[model samples]
Target: MGSAVSLRRFPSPEERPAALRVCRLPGVYAPQADTRLLVAQVRHEALWPGVRSLDLCTGTGIVAVAAALRGARATAVDVSRAAVAASRLNALLHGCRIRVLRGDLDGPVGRERFDLVTVNPPYVPSQDARAPSRGARRSWDAGRDGRLLLDRICVRAPGLLTPSGVLLLVQSSLSGVAATLDALGRGGLRTRVVERRTEPFGPVMSARAEWFAALGLIAPGAWTEELVVIRACRS
Candidate 1:
């Protein structure tokens, strides 16, 4: 696409009120500072023109639109029906062709290999039913240890990639970044951080720590909020 634009903006935590701007989609989700960072990261990458691209957990299809704007044939997938609908609508709004599919990770795009795959999977660890935002519950929560979906993606990724394909994923250090790297390695993928940032912990993280303590899984002062974006390729 055009030169990548930086979406990262600093608003004081209190000033960073969640705003409702229409995404490239139907319904609304909280668009935070990190979302912009993600868009910029993808824009800076060397995307092969006219190559096929896949956006896992496509949500509002922002990433897919970016890919299409860059001339790649993009497909976006999400487990939530609303997200799928939103993505399609957003693609239309952007005047870009981004195929939307409803299914987990690679489920809907069966046997379809792509030159690039991008995902912004949920990376929060929480057991509090109320901790997640409506969108976060569906798109952000990664179960108890926060590796639920990430683990699955790593295992399934190699099979989904073209011989030269790469995966770009965003995850929280609070969810254990090192462990995630290990998981990818076990799946025969080599990974490197493309971006790193510190954000405040959301409610889910507090709940996760409490639950962990209750179950003797950790001592106090062990968890904090930090996120990292990683680029992975088959080893």
Candidate 2:
């Protein structure tokens, strides 16, 4: 494992592949640790020309662009129009031909299957039972237990994959890593945690620390969370 790459500013082309020049649009989820972690796993995959890939909840479409750079024909989907636009802009900026769609997780893709599916959805435990319809918070506010989207992805991902397809997903430990694995396993996919990273709480988590602690989601004074990348395969 290497040091986490900060997304405070877009990385220079010299720092990363030109295709990864992702822009952080307002109200769109920025590429952060989880995004980089998932992209790293994307680079490790055996991608080739015509390898179809899909990225769900693709905020800035960084993951889709990463797959495209590796010769995978990528499609990105997001419920937010801003996210769809950002994904398209980033793909165009990198000259990567990615199909960007505005829809809920895995919804726009319909019955279309792919060789690979990647996701970095909202997994933060929130007081609200329903996710926000708009604003930056919409990018990470998962309902109560934070499994709102994660659970749906687990159930839907298996059907989205090719016979030998793979799914790479990232989420925080607070969101129940074992539950995700179990859900994917129940869906008939073999799953494993391929990467684990401990990071300090960001603004959102920090703001809700007390409430999370009250709910016993974290230790009273704990201010950090583990991010894990789980890989599920249809082998």
Candidate 3:
């Protein structure tokens, strides 16, 4: 086991006004730049009028609320009760009818399918054994190799999607974007990068260099972290 990584507490809606609130609250990990970028991409490229959508791991329900704002009936899910509560409150605050559920990825939505599914799961690859803070544990830790949640989501996505439905997911460059794409492909879904951003701070940047070094994917030095927006559909 390795030393525990310190994590930042998730911000609350009170900390930021609703009008300017772009991420979820009461969770350790706030929405990253990738999240906002992906939302914009989905809004511009994929969303259609009256489409039903699912937001997997919806933290503050920002994605679900955005989808509803765009005329997509939306449902948001998260494993943390606090997250579900925050999402529900946020939805109500926005006067949107987004449904909120508490369960692991895909557990809350169960068998029901949607025209679109979006996920912004924890993608940090760490060997830390210390129990993370509530928000960190649920929203930041991505297992020893960072693909734990991503793998599960991709494997189950095929069943949750409507025949022509698409999945939009965000992953960090530190997690090996190419490997993630390959994993999605093996799960029978084709992928493409719809968005990318380089950030210098946050929990992701902390162990990024070390992780990348061990993986031998990039040379040791200051490297930019990329947010990959992957679009996948049933073939």
Maximum-TM-score candidate: 2
What digit string (tens of lDDT, one per residue) describes model 3 on residues 187-222? 788788877777764655555677667766456775
Task: State residue 194's C-alpha deviation in candidate 2, in Å.
Answer: 0.3
Q: Which stretches of model 1 miss by more than 4 angstroms?
A: 1-29, 128-136, 203-224
The predicted structure with the larger lDDT, 2 or 3, is 2
**RMSD, model 2, all Cα superposed?**
4.8
Q: Is candidate 1 or candidate 2 better by TM-score?
A: 2
Assess every candidate by TM-score. Answer: 0.78, 0.93, 0.82
Ranking by lDDT: 2, 3, 1
**lDDT for each residue of candidate 2 in 74-101, tens digit (9 for 90 to 100):** 9999999878888888888778899999
By the TM-score metric, which is better: model 2 or model 3?
Answer: 2
Model 3's C-alpha root-mean-square deviation from the true structure amounts to 5.9
Pairs of residues at least 3 apart in sequence or in different chains that clash in candidate 1: 1-70, 24-90, 25-90, 122-140
lDDT of 1 by residue, 1-235 (tens): 2223223222332343532223432333344545555666667778877988998877777777777878989999987776777777667766889888888789898898988888888766667433344553756666677777788888888788888888888877656788878888888888898888777555556656766667554566556555688888975
Clashes of each: 4, 0, 2
lDDT (0-100) at residue 214 of candidate 1?
A: 74
Clashes of 3: 2
